[model samples]
Target: MPDIISIGEILIDFVSMESGVTLAQSPGFLKAAGGAPANVAVAVSKLGVKSGFIGTAGNDPFGRFLKDTLNSYGVDTCHMDLTDEARTTLAFVSLTADGDRDFVFYRHPGADMMLRKEKISEDYIKSAHIFHFGSISLIDEPARTATLYAIDIAKKHGLIISYDPNLRLNLWPDEETARKTILSTLNLPDILKVSEVELEFLTGIRDIDSGLKALKDKTSASLILVTRGIEGVDYVYRGERGHVETFKDVKAIDATGAGDAFVAGVLYGIHERINEFKDGHMTSKALQDILRIANACGTITVTKKGAIPALPTIDEVKRFLSERLER
Candidate 1:
């Protein structure tokens, strides 16, 4: 059984080969496997943790590529479903001069949305110490119900639930629906990871103090993590707040999967110290250690391109930290 299970979209990202090119003007593309939950599953596996992915993909070539990618990275894909009903989802990514991206998705009821509740494996959900998910899966029908069902099983088994909004407004009918859907599930996870913008947008508050206060009140989650690009990451855990500064001079080529890598680092930390976490002995020092590694993971990711392709191995992360410390 894997230590962690991540469920959500597993799709192909067609990245523009030329920098600062729009989708219309871009000359070529490079295909890579991507999806928040799937990226996290592969990230954890790269760090030597047993991980499993549960999602739906088209029974097409792209879907097969994604499945093969996950297996190559040591993620168990036994729970993944292949459907002939729909083609795989695809995202065409064009980048700005600064490596920021624009996305155009081609998923008119993609295979991922076809994940029925009946297809979910209850035993797979229970076997993990942690279950991580993203909000995108909740936007659709059968996948939505199946996601909630998996959460219920994880909760019943006392597994730590992790939720990342990984908000993509375009996936929803409107901003109102996206906000309502994500906010409704805020309290479900024991650990929550959000972007600084997401925190403010969800709470309708600009200041971190006011915004987090509003957010904490809504959730049974004990830990709330907010990531600020380059400005670093901050958190509120059990009423205590802390922040960690990011590494300087990143020179990022692409930042697509940095957040997922960070999430994986955090979960890996929790897996390593499961006893301390279970016993309620998560000291500030322990958290700092985890966040440091998480930050490092994110930093290493952007230096490369794509999501799963850029994730660092545990040894790579250690080497990165050591080099930084020596500097």
Candidate 2:
């Protein structure tokens, strides 16, 4: 049994080797295991915490590789399914001059869509203290229903729910539908991580404070984090708010999965102080420390290429913080 369980998409990422190019301009790519929730799973596991992944991967070469990759990171995949219903999903990523990412997905009917509600085990979900997910799987069927059902189970079992909309506008049929669909379920998670832009899109407010206030009114989330890339994270926890700055001056080559790495850091921090979070007594100072590590995770990730491979281990994160302290 794992302390954390993350459920959703598991796929391959084809990252363009060259920076400062669009997908059409990039000449080549590097195949790597990715998918937001899966990245969180591996990132937490790398921190030496027990985490499990539950989702569907195709019974193909890419899918098999993803399964092996999760295992290599010591992530539990007991409830993971390998299905023949659809081929694995693939996303081609190209980078801008500033290491920002642009994505083009190749999933007519991705194997991740094969995530079956009936196959999800209630006991497995209950075994964990936290359940993490993203909205990508919410874009379609089977997975949508399955995600809802799992959320229901996690809530019933009193697991701390975590959501990072991980919104990819291109994946949706239209912006309005994406907004409406995601908005309808805001009241679900205990923890919510959204980028500053995501909060703006969801709340229709450019002002970060007003947007966070709007989101807080809608959800039961005790903690809401707004990531601003290298600018760092702005957060509100149970009515107390603050900002945490990221590591300064680190060269970035690829920004893929940095958000996921940050998500894992936050979750692992809560996982460490499960009782305090569950009891609604987690202080802003404690959370500040947590976000600092999360920011470190994000910074360390951008300095490398690919998603999973870039995620730092707990020791790696500790070393990073130690070095920063010694500076």
Per residue, candidate 2 scores C-alpha lDDT tens digits across 19-104 of 98788888999999999999999999998899999999999999999999999999999888999999999999998877899999
What's model 1's overall lDDT? 0.91
- Once fitted onto the true fold, the runs of candidate 2 whose alpha carbons sit more than 4 angstroms away are none
Model 2 C-alpha RMSD vs. true structure (Å) is 0.8
Write the residue-wise lDDT of candidate 1 on 1-327 in tens digits: 899999999899998888787899999998999988999999999999999999999999999999999999999999999899898999988888777778899988898888889988888888889999999999999899999999999999999999999988888899999999998998799999999889987999988778888888878788889899898988888888888888867788888899999999999998898778767789999988999999999999988878889999999999999998898
- List per-candidate RMSD values in Å: 0.9, 0.8
Please name the candidate that would achieve the greatest lDDT relative to the true structure. Answer: 2
TM-score for all predictions?
A: 0.98, 0.99
Model 1 pairs whose backbones collide? none
lDDT for 76 (candidate 1): 97
